[model samples]
Target: MDRRRLLTTAVLGGAAGLVGATALGSLSPEDVWAAEGANAKINPGDPDPNFVEGRVTAVSDAVVFVTSSDGTYHSIRVTTGTSIWKLNPSTLDEVKVGDGLYARGVRMPDNTLAADSLWVNIVNLNAHVDSIGRGHLNLDHHGQRVVAHVEQGRSAAVYNNTPAVSDMSMLQAGKHVKVIGAWHPDTNEITISTVYAAV
Candidate 1:
């Protein structure tokens, strides 16, 4: 077998006996996302060619089948080393048909992706802050109002390229911000994991 397939087989063997947190490891979703992108030669903001965005159409053993939003079909191979995020670090069992996915991984010679990281129902949105309420922010995203809830202890804010902090006190009304969070499918609501705004 080729090196990639060989490595995948080994991981599948090792992962079959593990589940939950022990199988997924402690890496944050963004850590895996950014780390994989950083190692590639793509420019910042340029879509990583190794990335795939789609909806899960099927799942079998360690493989997930997806149909991209644009209609391309993909086979994603998940191994123990893959970091999965479904709201938080997750297991493959949490993935379901119809769930949206964003995956980054190495492409095998057969055109399958050997997934390094998989994020289910994740959204990165740009919006204008309309108002702030008790533990939440009302946002206007492309003219649609959205309710973003602050997940205390997990929610954080990043300002002007500085380190992220849990304090969201600097957010102001009518300012533009980028939101990275888990989307509540079919609804204009999300739970904020990180908010990027000016200090």
Candidate 2:
């Protein structure tokens, strides 16, 4: 079995086992994200109302400060329940200064977002697999060049509505793919999160 899959499944199963973990007067970080997300009044398909997307300018314990592209400032608070995803499901330690983040949660009266989820360096793009290398993919996204990295155990492929598979051998040259990934800041490069193919 894939190690990444095991890690994710274990975390999710642990979260399940922790049910009423809160009732015991304590909850895990996984529980926090589940609980907070369940409580928020969110509009489906619309960008999260209180979502904040920015680069980390500072990190002080559980609080991370960010500056958006438009120069607006936002403070996002990470909790035990908040889910943090880097190239894969990760922990807060993977988050660092200068990392880009997309946070979804409740905006407190004090202006800090109590984040339920944080997707660090995440991006979604529609591109053509222009070429392939031993461990990389050259992509053309609307005429823009992008280099997509292949992280073993982390990268997967989805073909024709089927489940994603670890083998990327089916990804042929000149094919179009909808890719979700972690975009390297200020660069055309991205570490693929998932690569979905139409045919």
Q: What 10-residue stretch in candidate 1 is worst by lDDT? A: 16-25
Report every candidate's CA lDDT: 0.80, 0.73
Query: In candidate 2, which residue ranges exceed 4 Å CA deviation?
Result: 1-49
Q: List the residue pairs that clash in candidate 1.
A: none
Candidate 1 per-residue lDDT, tens place, 1-199, comes to: 2334543554547533243323433446556545654567888888666789998999999999999987999999887667788877789999998888988767776888877678888877899999999999999999999999999888899999789999999999999999888887778888998899986
Show pairs that collide, candidate 2. 29-80, 29-81, 32-81, 33-81
- Candidate 2 lDDT for residue 178: 83
Write one digit per residue (lDDT tens) for candidate 2, span 1-199.
Answer: 2322322333334442222212222222223333555645667766555778889998887788999887899988766556677776677788888899877666665778866568788777888999999888999999999999989988888899798888888898899898878888778899876788876
TM-score of 1: 0.76
Global CA lDDT computed for model 2: 0.73
* TM-scores of all candidate predictions against the true structure: 0.76, 0.75
**Error of model 2, residue 69, in angstroms:** 2.0
